[model samples]
Target: MFAIFLFVPARADAAFCKTGETVTLEGEIIIPPVIDGGEWFWPGKFAKRPCQVTTLRGKGTLPKECAVGKRMSLTGRVLDAGIVTLEVASIRCY
Candidate 1:
C-alpha cells in the first residue's frame, strides 16, 4: 500500500486593510462612468482590485497630473476594509 498527500498554499481572498488604520498604497487612479461618482484605486500591476476612495483630504491637494488611468501613490486612513474604503491624506502622481 502507498499513501500520497497533496500540498496547497493558502490564498488570500482580499487584500488586508484594517479599518481606521493609516496606510500608503500605490496604484492607478480609476474614475467611474457615472457623474458625481468618486474615484477608485486599482492596486498592484496584475491584480487590479478596486478600492473606493471616499474622500480626499489632509496633507496635500490632488495634483493635475493625477488623472484617471495614471499611476499614483497615496496615504490615507481605511474606513472600511471589506470594500477597501480610504480617506486619502496625500496623493502623488508618478
Candidate 2:
C-alpha cells in the first residue's frame, strides 16, 4: 500500500518591501476584515495574502475607479517593512 498527501500552498506573509526603499507594487486592493482596519494590497498576480499600507500620501487621491478588488499600482517609499507600510507617492488603477 502507498500513502500520499497533498497540501495547498500557504499564503506568503513576508513582503518584498524594505524600509527607505522606493518600490512600485502592483496588486489588487483588499479591505481588511476588521472594522476600522486600513486597506491592504496583495502585491502580485494571484497573491494569496495581503500587505497593509499604514498611510498613503503624495500626488494622487484614491481614484473612484480604484475600488476594492481592483488591480492597482502603488509607487512609494517603504516606511515599515514588517507591516508593509508605505508612503505612497503615486497610484494607478486599471
Candidate 3:
C-alpha cells in the first residue's frame, strides 16, 4: 500500500530587534503590555503576530491623525528590526 502526505510551506520570520535599530510595527497601542508597550516596541510582524514601537526616532514629527492611548494599525518599513525602531508610513485608527 502507498500513502500520500501534504506539507505546508514555512513563512520567513522577522529578525530580532535591539537597541539603535528600526522595525516595522502594527496592532494595538496598548498601555503596559510590556514596559512601554505602546512606547517601546515588542518587535515582530504585525500581520502574523503582535509588534511594538519603542522609539519614533523623532524622524520627522508625531502623527496628528492618530491619538495617543488609542488602538491603531500602523505600517512602516523597519530601518532596523533589532531593538525595534520604526519609520511610520501609515496608520489607521480603530
Candidate 4:
C-alpha cells in the first residue's frame, strides 16, 4: 500500500525542460555555505545557470519561501544551452 501510494505523482510535479529551452536561477545554499574573502555570504553568487538536470540529479523545483539570500537550489529549464550562473540559493545566519 505504501509503495502504491508513493507511486502516485503529486499535482505540482516539477517542470520538464525541452531540448533547447533555458532558464537561470540563483540562490543561497546551506548544503555548503559559500565563502568570499573568508566571509560567510548569506547570499552566494550565481551558483547554477543553464544547468542540465538529468532524471537522477537536478533541481526539479523549489518553494516560494526560498529567498535570494536564503540557501536554495533552483531547478528550471534552460532556454538556451551552455549558459550557467553562480548565484545564491538561500541563507544560514546561524
Each candidate's clash count: 0, 0, 13, 34
Scored by CA lDDT, what does every candidate get? Answer: 0.55, 0.55, 0.46, 0.36
Best by TM-score: 2
TM-score of 2: 0.52
lDDT of 4 by residue, 22-94 (tens): 4444334445433445333222133433243332123223344544455444433333234322222332221
Candidate 1's displacement at residue 28, Å, is: 1.4
Clashing pairs in 2: none
Cα lDDT of model 1 by residue, 6-69, tens digit: 9876853445556787777666567522223344433333222333344433333347787778
RMSD of 3: 6.7
Task: Summarize candidate 3's per-residue lDDT along 1-94 as a digit string, tens digits.
Answer: 9999888668555444444433444555443222332343332334323344444332333345445466556556545555455555655555
Number of the predicted model whose lDDT against the real structure is largest: 2
- Colliding residue pairs in candidate 1: none
Candidates in order, TM-scores: namely 0.51, 0.52, 0.37, 0.24
- Cα error, candidate 3, residue 46 (Å): 11
Model 2 Cα lDDT, one tens digit per residue, 14-77: 4445578777766666752222334443333322123435454344235676777777677778
The candidates, ranked best first by lDDT, are 2, 1, 3, 4
Q: For each candidate in turn, give its C-alpha RMSD to the true structure in angstroms.
A: 6.0, 6.6, 6.7, 10.8
Which regions of candidate 3 fall more than 4 Å away from where they truly are? 1-24, 30-48, 57-65, 81-83
